[model samples]
Every structure is written in C-alpha cells, then in structure tokens.
Target: MIAAISENDIKKLKEDLKQKGYKLTPQRRAIVDTIIAGKGSHLTAEEIYDEVKKLCPEIGLATVYRTIILLEEIGLIYKLELNDGCSRYELANKDEVHRHHHLVCNKCGSVIEVQDDLLENLETEIEKKYNFKIKDHSVKFFGLCSECRKDG
Candidate 1:
C-alpha cells in the first residue's frame, strides 16, 4: 500500500536535500513514499528495499544505503542500531518526537517506546556533576513483553 505523506512534506524534503547538495531522484522518492506509508517507527533497509523494488526494480541496495545515510545526515530520519546488530530507521518530526529508551520483547522482537522524564533528569545531573556536555544518548531495556510473559 502506498503511504500518505503530504505534498508539502515531499516538497520540504526535496528542498532540504537540495540544500545538502543531493538530488531527489525517483528511487529515493519511492523509498520516502514507502516510509511515509508505514505505521510503525522501526524499518530496516531491506524492508525499504523491498518496498521500493515494487516501484523500481532496478534500484540497488547500495543506493538505498546511500540514500538512507544522506537522509540521516539531514535529520530527516533516525538510525536505530539495535542490540541484535541490525540498523533500523524512523522518521523524526515534532509530532512523533524522539523518546529515550525502549521496552523490547526478546521473544517476539517487538519494540515499544518508553517515556521517562527521570532518565532525562539523570542525564542532566550527570552532565552537571561531571562538568561535561551531553549531546545525545540511546537506551534499551530487553525482556519479555506482557503478552509474552503471560504466555510463558
């Protein structure tokens, strides 16, 4: 299914890419369309490749990787490196704000977002105590999800 991303969003993305000296090619546009269609935040490069292939079978994996890297550099998406040694991606925007930490189900490999103001405070305290500046951080908590635990 084709995802619904606003025309304004596409135009803005193209402007952003042009600012960074990148062109909005048809392949990259199709990839963005697939990402826009998806519901969840987590997506793998292979997943993107599969979706884009429907529109452009001639597109290559390397091109997808390169496009993802470029998009990441412009802060259009966040690259998530899970403990399982694979990278996933999600769009970053004001509405779908980035959160700290995740509740991951080990058995089912599901990821749920966890919001913790305490974690933000702790990071601030650490930075103050050490007289150091913190830019960004990532955290993950792994265990059985409620359903998995109940099923066990």
Candidate 2:
C-alpha cells in the first residue's frame, strides 16, 4: 500500500516546484492532491484524469499526462511497471526509505504491497563485488493470491 502525503509535504512540494522554476498551477495542484488522496490505489493516467476532472472540469487528458511526467521528472512520484500492461503511479517516499515491493496475483490481477526491503544484502553484495552503485530497485512477485488460490 502507498503511504499518505501530509499537508506539510504538499507545501514542501510546492516550494520545491517554485525553486525549480516551475509554477504550481491550479490544475497541477489538483492533480497532485488527487494522487495524494488516492495513496494506495496506484492510479493510472486515465484514472487520474477522471478524478481530476471532477475537481477541475476544464482539465484535459493531455494536461494530466504532462503533469504526471513533470511530477515523475521532479522525483515526486514513481512510475511503476507492474507487468499488468498499464503503468501505475505512487508517491515517492519522502524519507528516502527503501520502496516496498509488490506481489501481483496472476489469476486475479490484484497487487499486494510487500513493505520489507528484501534486497538489502543483495544490493550490498552487488555493490561490494561489482563496484556498481545501486540507486534504486523494484521487485514484483507473480503468483496466485489467497482468494485466487482458493478459487483455483
């Protein structure tokens, strides 16, 4: 599950945007608020657009796409490829903690979040042996979830 973004975090993000020579427009703020509100949902672009439309009726799909791209560029959000064809997005961890992995149910297409950092030792080993710095990583385990296993 995704973590919630506090109001202070939002204020900090707006300040960061201004410092980076970007304007926090109403549409962009609405988009960010929507994403923050739907923390655990891993919303897609279309889903975000649909929700943002409710807040700003004049907002367009292209604007949502551009805003998402900008957010990802600014390291405020993560674009995830969960192997379900559509790209999903979640807020970036503000504390620089390791990101949670995902358990994707192949049968039902449900995504379950795994909060542990399972690759700490592996990352250390790789860095020590190969002298390759690991900036970030993601893992996805594919299998049947409890309900899907029962059904199968």
Candidate 3:
C-alpha cells in the first residue's frame, strides 16, 4: 500500500519545480506522486515507470528515467546502489539533520529503513581529522531478514 502525501508537500514540490523552470505537467505530477506514495520502498526506475504508466498511459520509460535523474539532481530524491545491480530511489526527508540507513535483505531483496543516525561519530571524526565538510551520506547493510533467517 502507498502512503498518503500531504497537500503541503505537493504544493512545495510544485513551487520547487516552477523555480527550477520546469512546469509540473500531468506526467511529472504522476511520477512524483508515485514516488511519494512509495515512501519507504526504494523503487527502481522500471518499478516507478510501471506505476506511473498506470496513471498516465502515454508516459514513456525514457521520460520516467529522465525525470528520476532530474529529481535526484535537484536533491528531491536519493539514488541508492544496494549491490543488487539495480539502482533504487527514495524520497529525501525535509529534515536533513537525521538521515536514515538501509538494511537490505540479501535473500528476498527487501529494503528496510533504519532511522538511526549511526554515522554521527564517524562523520565528526572524519571532518575533524580531514578538515572536510560532510553534507550527506548513505549506508546499507546487506544481510538476511528475519523471515529469511528463520527459513534458513
């Protein structure tokens, strides 16, 4: 099941696109809505395309791919490479202070969201030692999920 997106979020997204000189057309809206609906699920381009096609039959795969790339470039989404040979994406949270990690199930290919900011210490150490500024990061732990471990 898809999560419900708030009207405020939709309005802000529309304003963002307009500021970027991109019109929020029906196809674009459909694509964004699909991504927002699958909040926790890291959906692949093909998966997103399939979902968007249900709303806009005339939308093409290339358009979906392009839009995904554009959204990622604009920091509206995060692209993840979970070592599954397929790129997945999730929406960027409004509060950038708390970033979430991922627990990927190797057996079933399920992606679980881990909300703990486990890298705060590491990030602080790296910044202090290297004199570098860290803007963002992503972490993924690959292992068997509960059901998969039980079956094994």
Candidate 4:
C-alpha cells in the first residue's frame, strides 16, 4: 500500500494551493480526504465523488471532476491512464523523482503496483545516447495476474 497521508502533508498541500492562488474549499477538502483514505486504490472521479458525497452530501460530481483537474494541474496528483477506459489518480510522492510503474491485469482489471524502478539503466542509456535531460518517466505493463493465469 502507498504511504498514508499525514496531517503535515495536508497542511503543506494547503499552503501549496494558497501559493498557487487556490484555496482548499470544503468540497475540495472532502475529495482530498477521500483520496488520502483511498491510497493505492487509484480512484476515479466517480468513485471519489461517491465517497465525498458521504461526507458532503450536497457535493456534486462536477465539483469532484473540477477538483481532480485542479489537483492534477498543480502536480499534487498523477492521473494514470490504462486500457480500462477510466482515468485513475494517485497522490504524487514528492520524495520520488520518478513515478512508480504499474502492472495491470488484463483479465481481472486489477492493478498491481510495481514499486521498483526497473528503468534506471535504460533511462541512463537513453540519456547518454540522446543527451537528454531525463527527469521522470511512467511505465505500465499489462498481462494476466497469477489468479487469472491459474483460472485460464
């Protein structure tokens, strides 16, 4: 599971938003709290809205969508696009320069997070060859999970 969000992290996020001329309103806070609580789930906007509605019953789906977009815009979250036709999101880890890779099970539609940075050597070689300043990268591998293989 991903690291749990801390109160300090939330405070820092609020300050970051303030610096960016945005405020963390009540609805946004509920959405963010839901995202924090759902770590490693890679929740979609609809799922976030559903959870946020439990807290802010008057919350609208459009607000969730807008908050998600703003968070992505501010680099507070990362939107992961897989073949499932749903845009999933996870909190950005400030300590990690590169986003962790993901293993997507094609059969069961389950995501297994790959915590290893398996592309370092390849990234180094590419940077050396192309003289590119590599910052970060994302990778997703799709295949059947162990259970799916067993069932198949």
What tens digits encode model 4's per-residue C-alpha lDDT throughout 1-152? 22356889779889989998989898888877788788789999999888889899998898899899999888888899988899999988787879999999998999998888889999999999999989989999999999999998
lDDT of 2 by residue, 1-152 (tens): 22356788778888878887888898998888888888778999999999999989999999999999989988889998878889889988776566779999999888898878989999999999999999888888999999999997
Model 1: colliding residue pairs: 3-37
Score residue 70 of candidate 3 by CA lDDT: 79
Whole-model Cα lDDT of every candidate shown, in order: 0.81, 0.87, 0.87, 0.88
- For model 1 the local lDDT of residue 90 reads 76
Clashes of each: 1, 0, 0, 0
TM for candidate 3 is: 0.90
What is the per-residue lDDT of model 3 for residues 1-152, given as tens digits with 9 covering 90 to 100? Answer: 45677889778877888888887788987888899898887899999999999889999999999899878877788898989899988889988675589899999988888887889999999999999999888788999999999998
The TM-scores of all predictions, comma-separated, are: 0.85, 0.91, 0.90, 0.92
User: What overall lDDT, based on C-alpha atoms, would model 4 receive against the true structure?
Assistant: 0.88
Q: Comparing 1 and 3 by lDDT, which wins?
A: 3
Off by over 4 Å in 1: 96-100, 115-118
**Model 3 poorest ten-residue lDDT run:** 1-10
Q: Please give the distance, in angstroms, between residue 86's alpha carbon in candidate 4 and its true position after superposition.
A: 0.9
Instruction: Supply candidate 4's per-residue lDDT for 17.
Output: 90
Better of 1 and 3 by TM-score: 3
